[model samples]
Target chain A: MESEKAKILPFYVLIDVSASMSGDKLDQANRIMPQVVDALAEAPILADKVRFCVIDFGSDAQVRLPLCDVLDQHSSLPSLTIRGATSYAAAFRLLRSEIEVNVKQLKADGYLVHRPAVFFISDGEPTDPEHEWRTAFQDLTAGFPTYPNFVPCGVDSANPRTLATLIHPASGPKQMQMYLMEKGQNPADAIAAIAEILISSMLASGQSMAQGSSGMILPAKQDLPAGISAHSSDDFV
Target chain B: MAAPEEGPVRPVPEGKWQGYVEPFVVGDPGRAAAGVVPLPDESAWDRKDTVLDAFALREGRARIVEVRAASVRGLAHRAYGKVRQDEYGFRRTANGRYLVVCVADGVSSGELSHKAAMIAAKGGARWLAGLLDRTEPADLPWGQFIRGVAVMIERNGRKLLRGRDDLDAEKCDVREVAQRLATTVLYAVIDLHAVDGTHAVHVVTVGDTSAWVLREGGRWEPQEAVKNDGAEVFSPTVHALPLPPATEPVPVRTTVRAGEALVLMTDGIGDPLGQGTGPVGRFLADVWERPPASGLEFAGQIGFARKSFDDDRTVVAVWPVNGR
Candidate 1:
């Protein structure tokens, strides 16, 4: 029974395509897309166990990349553009549909589907009112097997308060991590850090699954950046 | 039903309930002090809940519950600096049984500002718990409560800095550490009652920490002053105050009614009462006009504050459940 549960984790990258993200924000995201895909391809464990999806939200939300395994070399990741108002509600609705369909199909195939993780990067206030997104958010988050872990990364130009509201309801700010990527800091570096966090979390989840528990531990800060070497092994375990 | 036995069945006494509190501290692995002996988990005062005691009360009940959510990151220019300005706080008390919600921001100038902010939160909750033990649910004195909290913080601030080896030689006094570690604390205690009963909210703050009240009618009011015209400029280096004895405490208070939501936050949210339009202003308006869907929604609004502004921010909000 345990072996039948294929430990496949789906990661959804939700990018904000609002007009405010047009300049550096859009360029940085575009520059890092290929790197993110390449990194996943390089990690054999992640390649086998993880799937990727992309949802771009502007005046409307569109799924640029559907759920596909990294090992499938035929899959081509698409470039995202910035152009519309930030309609968070539309993006969330589309994501809910994607998750439900994929999760259902995976389950029927006897594959274990971990609650999908969402990395929502946004830089503006929602164009819609609070009520516009409430019911949809509650329903979507509730549908997950476990509470969905939504990490909303805020750009310096964006509104942090609005980003906070977009995360899953159960998580506190302490659990919501943030990093600032300046104008010249390699976009690939930031993407690498994010990839490291996600991959490391997936590996940790795998270990805990094998041990018959659901505990997960994040990698130390040094281990997260590709070039930075871990100085003190005892610092974090 | 069988006729009651002649002898009264001894009522099962309520079980003795003991509460436990612990504080866990994880220093940034990237910046561990060399040769410094790391304190044992049990020995380190970080994890112990210094304020967990129960008191006897009459059968008729009233209680207050609160929860806080916060997150912060070091500024881009200073991410690797010795002082990493990150926000930290928790929902120290939950609404279901008893709640205590507090959010504090340590002045960045203080070398140990983060530690001070954490200690203030933990200490403030303990102090509030102690106050609740003595006062009745409805009769909670807003003024006295604020004063009591001020005194407790002042005292705790003194204790936290006493005999610290980290003190600077050029500035040898507790006030230096106290002022550097000076944090603005904002907290709310909600008294819960049955459907027909009234609930009260008591809020307190010093410096620029802000509190907002949202009503069932969808109107929101600033519970505390948002802008600090005379706000003290925090200095990383401790300097002697020329104005008055540094021991005086500053206190403010306000009351909240039933079906109202209260939000407490640090300056990291920007001056909610400040001039012109800002994200904090918009957020204050949103919370005032609409009922947050959940605690996460409240937190998300606070997170939105970080995008447009650059400061370590924290917010604690409370929504009392209406009785049926």
Candidate 2:
């Protein structure tokens, strides 16, 4: 009975809420976010180890949803408001601080915290030209056990180079790496599909960590639109 | 009264659907007892021997106890058949000179891993027993022994294929054959020759499956383990025998105090206890405080609902009683 206490794997989704991602992108993000939580709720075994959160970024980013235990998280995600510009630094800053607070609360409640995973989605370039995102990203990847598996997913016009930086190669080899979604015929439908795949990967990675895996084992990649591709930094570089 | 299959029997299982092996079912919440039932004996259709229950033996100075079981998902996932891919073996020589213990885990993705897992668990113990029967005791080259086990797995796999006619009758895919039987090896030997209440042990391991000696000082380090700083993020880091990219095993030897205990387990138990995946900050104090138990009663202890667990769990915990 002593081993019955659950292990918590906090998963956060960072969705770009800038003007560029307003119509089809925002609709898909809003629609597909609930499915991620539902997938966890459906599988009790997987649900036991996972906690969910959502961060929406533009001129600023804030937690659209708090860290909700997968088993106890019944409500759907709150609709994200359209913000001014794509601010990569704002997203990273919100994520790092929110994770620190979430993880602390989880441990205080007697939960064993697995490494966190951040699933980020964006459609445009960073508005913060000061390269301030790099500083905040460094703080996110800093030492002392709050490092998260940063998996950035690119959609319609999102710069692959900036998306690549989200993976933080200097940190070391990562589990949930990065992916580029296809600019398919329908942007809304394509974004929704990519969201589904990302959520599935998050569930699989969380389950693997609980089972003593190396913390970032991704689910097998299903055949995707020919336009999509994958990239991973060797040794987290 | 079916005795152990005598002589050099065909290593390959009789036809997949032809044999009278006990059938296993997926986990059912409505069921009152454990879905797992041990085979009656090592015979056709008997459930007693197949059940991975607890087994224990006490020698002059040390006591060894082990429990092995199928993963909760593997037990519940009714894809083809519910079979366990974890195996373990223990043997003490007649002269009481050495005690050998080993554990192995078949890759979940492997096709014929249940059979291969049994081979791995016993292969090391068998080698040490046979060597003792022929040669005199001396400082064993621990590296040579692990490397030998890896080579033996590759050879015996071919021999088993040769023993069966089905392979010759219909060509089986060669790559699939190796992939289907992949498994991890953690082999160990402990000297019974205790002088002034201490015993020397040699351990060699491949992959993430681990072994640790719990010192009486409330500290623990893996037996023969190089420090893994958590830099490697790959999931399947196992150095399986005879598989591609064969990496050589490194062995380490250490002397243990009388009150110390040894823990050998597959990733199922190792990861959570050691917190390899993340920081197990809470309830660290409440983990495994009581002394070990005797029978299948230990099975209940392992079956508890740990958050980050649910694989084929196998553990061998040894305590040297006389040394204390």
lDDT per model vs. reference: 0.51, 0.60
Runs of candidate 1 with Cα error greater than 4 angstroms are: A1-237, B1-68, B74-98, B136-171, B194-198, B216-218, B229-259, B270-279, B284-297, B305-308
Candidate 1 lDDT over residue span B162-266, tens digit each: 676766534455455455455656556655443344455556555556677655565546665435232121111221111122333333344454466566666
- Write down the C-alpha DockQ for each prediction: 0.02, 0.12
For B168-283, candidate 2 gives per-residue lDDT tens digits of 41255544455656677777777766668777777777666677776664455566543233331223456665463355555667766555666677765665555322232132
Point out where model 2 deviates above 4 Å.
A1-10, A19-28, A66-68, A73-79, A96-117, A123-191, A203-237, B1-50, B53-83, B94-97, B107-116, B134-138, B157-183, B190-262, B275-294, B318-324
Tell me the lDDT of model 1 at B180.
48
Q: What share of the true interface contacts does candidate 1 keep?
A: 0.00
The native-contact fractions of the candidates, in order shown, are: 0.00, 0.12
Candidate 1 local lDDT, A156-193, one digit each (tens)? 45555555555554344324344333444544455445
